[model samples]
Target: MLKNLKLTTSIIMLSSLLVLVAGCGSKKANDSKKEISVALNSELSSVDVSLAMDNTSSDVMEQVGEGLYDFTAKGGVKPALSTNKPKATDHGKKYVFNLRKDAKWSNGKPVTAKDFVYSWRRTVDPKTKSPQSYYFDGVKNYQAIANGKKAPSSLGIKANGKYKLEVTLDRAMPYFPSILAVSASFPLYQPYVEKQGKKYGTDAEHTLYNGAFTLKGWNGSNGEWSYVKNKDYWNAKHVQLDKVNVKVYKTEQTMVQQYQAKKIQFTQISGSTVKNLKKDQDLTVRKIPGNQYLVFNVKENKLFANQKVRQALAMAVDSNKLTKHVLQDQSLPATGYVPYGFNNSKTGKDFAKQAGQLVQNNKTKAQKLWAEGLKELGMTSAEFSILSSNTETAKQVDEYLQSQFETTFKNLKVRVAAVPFNSRLSKQNSGDFDTVLSGWTPVYADPTDFLNLLMTNNNNNNGKWSNSEYDQLIKDANDKYALDEQKRWDNMEAANKIAVEQAPIAPLFYISQVYLKDPNLKGMMLGPLGQPYYKDASYK
Candidate 1:
């Protein structure tokens, strides 16, 4: 049972690097100019939307790459490039999309239906090795191509004409439209990507934009980039801000100081700053649904093979203390894999309660389980190393866990190893650590968005925990013959229950997003998935 759990966590830490823009000292001085100044936590690796995986990079690319569909302010799907909702036929196995004739790239090229067909094929191609390729499994024949059993063209997506796209699905996906809004499904200009070769999407001049904003002076790897209004955008007149100046800061304190000095319009508050700025009139505190967890490398470590040991370690964690004391925010303690407010079903509620029953804060029980687990493994003392990013929050969490575990289990020696953020992420992806701190941002609003990440074969499942029963349940949930909505949800709930019972991951806490924005900023809508969209955002 310890081999089937998949864990995902989300938390933003403070960093110190800042991008200093030449000129533009004050907002008043730039009032006459048409530019919006924004601050981010890190430097963007690339402006290419499809290649980006992290929130910091994806948020920027969302502005440059408009999807065929987009999420509305109310969290519903809205058409972007498509003229209307897709037409389903052949018992929900096939879908046909009619494109808007006015949709065109910033370079004045028509946004053809073939662009999507090419993009989807490129994403799932084995050679491309996209981290997000797992999302395509729902599409018909995608798994076959990924597994080398079928040709790329065999995947059920094709252009009916220049402006019509036909897509075939393995089953009826309720959240299919929402999936289309994600960057991975966004249309890619095949001609442009091929013509520019390595330079494509590396800079403003290297690519074309179809969204409200077009890249101005962005060199993909640079700390500073600018977004100008796209003249060829279909709804260009609705774009209020003329230009958006983005600067990257690696630390929270640096960004806070810049925000205080009015160097930038917004920044995320962290550490001691959260306390001081809680009462500030300009600060805004919001709770997001993503959670953080400690993933155990069960495949690599023998000790983690025991379910009792995993459960004991999980019970020893005091998530309430970590969220309230260590990180002074109203972060919710995670009791289950699927966050509260995300879904409501009889099966989901039952499984959540069952999972919650496993969490215990008593050290005595933890010691008993630890001793039994060690005896089962024929060991006296168990020493293991945990990896965390070299940030204040990570260090504090690591210290908290280390102290708690030491007090609970006398025969255990858990060492905390801290590394830079990027290096830590790389090691986690490679499964090079016994345990690692990590988080997940939902690409779309669905239970499958969270459940699919933990599948044994999922790229995001760094721990490689596999379970046949869990895989079968997910397969059944996505099967088209399962017409009952509640029945599908039941299958998902059962799968999540199996995941929690496995205990390969210890759920920590749900992250709360804390931002310091100017009072004049209006129409800023934050979603449960990630950062809010800026298209409708404007100054009062």
Candidate 2:
């Protein structure tokens, strides 16, 4: 009996040990299951949707800030917080939207139409000092409010009851719905903003989200942030990922290292790294429209005030070689303000080629023009500095341009000034630099977004290039009484022609976006608007 009892006890002990071992193994497997990690080259500048400018911060905010409308992977506009498409009335000036009753903030407060109205008013209010105030020009009285001549209440947004929101545009904008899809134009929760007061959006606790994810742990200065699934999100059932991990690195080398270590699943590669990773299974490259150019400070430098001098400087740079050899992305050389893929009509020759023919490559013509401009300005040798961000890519491009301009233009001394990105932007905005390198991704898939950036009165027009004709063209396009697509296109194209001919801004090649994705990841989509959609993104 004793021997039998000993054997049975041993069997029970063995069974318990096996159960514990299996439990631990299962837990390890669960932990090892695939999770998506993204490594960015910069830190989040701000979580405030209206203030986000950089890609890294914008990417995170897109997942956290729920817009009434969203762009799908297939480039189709879809409803997110809205129940359906907005209704237009009063000759396209007024818009009515019905919010989803189920939409709630991450803090469990009901999201109402008042939230959008408050957000719009705040963005246009002069006291807010929003860098994106230019976007509100489409709204009625926004310009007056931004100039401090009108009250914020005069802005054209209203709340009817608890769920209905109304907006009045200064003019009919066919792309208005698309504009709402951008984070910069998205609505913020009013109560949440008021509750946080001055601390709003500086930390994870200060902001409220109504999207698929809610920020859990984030300090503004640190590069590390994590987003956990929002249980209160109206469409939480469709959210597949449990969490998203974002790690920021200032350089691509550091990001690539983390990616190689399997700590991150996605990154952007360029230059030598692009060549090195060409054969990697996870590497994928696509040609997208992004333009980099040198904008002359005509307001500060009299040399750039002359159209011939501007044109001469533009002609001196070999854009084709810069795109083909330096960028190595098969990028088409730029010759106009609007990018080729940026469409204003349904049919035409590619914009890039058509614009290229208008401005032919001729170094001899450029030299003569430069000589004439020098005589007009009464300067023996033109000396001006080009300011750019201190990124490695910017450094390389600056060096290349310095060599090209010095070699081509006789009696010209080109100096490069590199500063941090934020500081560089501040300097450019203050008109403290002679020339600056910058680019714009259109807020919508329209030519106006790019053209409007150079308008004389536009706040975002860093170059401060002003012309009555240019302003008139933009004004006519925005006249409340007119609603003609063909006329609008003509006016915009005319403005673009003027911009190119005047050469206040040098056109550069449209950039191609390159991103790396792991084999296990799926549903990751990149849009022409330059925003990443993570709503449907998942990993196996």
List, residue by residue over 1-540, the lDDT tens digit for candidate 1: 000001111121111111121112346413733555776654555666556655655666667777778765555566788887765687766878888888789889988899998888887888866777777787999888988898888888899999999899887655566667777788888988888877876777888677878877766556667778788888887777777777665567766766667666666665466887888888766555466788888888888877778878887988888888887866677777765434433333433444354444667777788888888989898888889877666777899999888878888899999876546766887789998977665665555666888887777888777889998888777673246656677787788777766777887877766677766656755433544456666765
lDDT per residue (tens digit) for residues 1-540 in model 2: 000111101100000000000000112112544345665554466788766655555667778887778765544467777888766788767888899999988878888998888888887777776777777787889878877899999998899999998889887766667667667677788877888887887878788888888987687667567778889988888888877766555566766766666666667666566777778888766555456788998888898988888898888788888877776645567777776664434344444544454444578888899999999988788888989877666777788888877887879999999876657767877788999988765555556667778878776777788999998897887663146655766687688788888888987766665556666667765543444456677777
So what's the TM-score on candidate 1?
0.87
Candidate whose TM-score is highest:
2
Q: Which stretches of candidate 2 lie over 4 Å from their true place?
A: 1-34, 195-198, 203-205, 216-218, 344-356, 480-482
lDDT of each: 0.69, 0.69
What is the C-alpha RMSD, rounded to one decimal, of candidate 1? 5.5
